[model samples]
Target: MKRAAMVVNPIKIKDMRLLHREVEQVMRRHGWAAPVWHETTIEDPGFGQTQQAISDQVDLVVALGGDGTVRNVSTTLLGSGIPLAILPAGTGNLLARNLGLPIRNRKVALRAALAGRDRAIDTLFVEIDTTGDGVADESAICTVMTGCGLDAEIMASTSERLKARAGWLAYPIAGLRHINARRTPMRIALDDNDFEDERPLTTVLVGNCGRLTGGVRLMPDAEPDDGVLDVLELSAERASWAPLITQVLSASTRTTSQVRHRTAESIRIECEEPTRVEIDGEVHEHALAVRISIKPKSLVVRVPRSSKPS
Candidate 1:
């Protein structure tokens, strides 16, 4: 019999026991042994626990949490050939949204996760170099997307308390505060191209998938299995944000002069000054430079066979 492990974020679900029972029932019905459950702690957000599951040689690993927990567990399981299933439980379940997983209903979501086919997805290998003295380099496997600039600022400004109370609405509330910040300068290089000279940058995002929160399609051409990253850079004055926001909210990908996009296998970016950086909606303090590359078919994810990515 194949064994499974569930890395759950207890804080996100109301009844932990009930959640386990449902997943357990599905596993048993599908010829899987009772799942070994691991709850994420405040300090360790499922990374180490996922590593443990990998070490145990489980046939499948189910992640039940927000994007952060899913990203952490995916990071640990990268290149292991074990399929990771996502059960959306938090505000921004970006991966689940893009994969067309059943996000609203827990029982259905769990069922889809367990019965899904193994889908190989490209993972973003990101390295961020911070500016401060003695600050260590940070790296992770970004599942959906990562960005630097205004998007990172919006995430940084969103308060945890407000996020816990207001959910996704908290992001817009915090974003209103930084809407007028001036664009920062950046030098960027795509693949083998030479560094593009400094330009005022509003935001630069590298995406493994196209969809954002609220069904927004930021990268029209992004695909998880495409073996390349979709790069988008926004350079706009404060006044330009209005139409851009409208285009995004409406899920329109029509090209605008203010936005430049490219599809590349690798990208390197350097900022004129320290700037906030974010991956999979988790914001970091600041970064001076970042190098991003894609590992094609590096992560095995479970997704419904009938679901086609847009």
Candidate 2:
């Protein structure tokens, strides 16, 4: 019998009771035999709870929330070699989509969690290097993408109330509000190459996986276990409403030729002024510089066996 635990965010979606029932039914079907459950509190994220579950020797840990919740679990189980399963209760189920997991029905997600195939996926470690002590201040493991600049600002400015009502579409409204803001120049160094850009950037994203919610393909070539990170620099010059509209049109066809893409083992970003950073859609305070690296095959996640592309 495989012992499993769930770290769920109770406030994610409107149908909490139904979600719980589905999860319980799936566990019974798989003969999990009374699995443990932990609810994530505002004070302590799912990561801390997941750590406790691992310490309790659970064979599998499931994250029952959105992208932020999944990221927290990923950080906790980075090197513990524990496999993670997702119950996509969040607005933007980016990581779940990347894994080719079903998200339309809670029962399907739960069944996949209970009896799905496992695949090794790469995770990104993002660290902020402070100026005063030259020491890193904060760091986290992200399964999807990390970004700074305008996109981060949009994430920061988006109100929880709006998110509760509008879900993932709330981002676009916030993005439009900040579209005309002046761009800040930044210095970018990827692997061994260095470049400077003067245009105000809307967002600079680094992705480990290609699929994003809403069918947006920010990094179409990104592969989760490829041992490399895909970097995308979106400047206001290129990311304006017109270009963005064009990209959205192209993304409908699964084409990313309108967007910029680069792949590297690591990346360094610096700006003349402080910039906000968002990892997996959760915003962080201003930072002068951030270093990101790929932890190849650091996580094992459940995916559909028939979902793998040939």
| TM-score for each predicted model, relative to the true structure | 0.94, 0.91
- Pull out the clashing pairs in model 2: 183-200
Q: By how many angstroms RMSD does model 2 differ from the true structure?
A: 3.0
lDDT of 2 by residue, 1-310 (tens): 7788889998875776766677777788888866688989999878689989999999889898889999998889888888999888887888888878888787787787777788899999999865634567988888998988887898899998988899889988888788677777777888777755544555778889877657777676788999999888765553556965667446432324335567899998886688889999998886788889999999999877666421
**Model 2 misplaced regions, further than 4 Å:** 13-20, 130-133, 193-200, 237-240, 248-259, 308-310
Each model's lDDT comes to 0.87, 0.80
Model 1 clash tally, residue pairs: 0
Q: What would the TM-score be for candidate 1 when compared with the true structure?
A: 0.94
Clashes of each: 0, 1
* Residue-wise C-alpha lDDT for candidate 1, range 212-295, written one tens digit per residue: 766678887788999999988887777898877776666555668777778899998888899988999889867988889999
Which residue pairs in candidate 1 collide? Answer: none
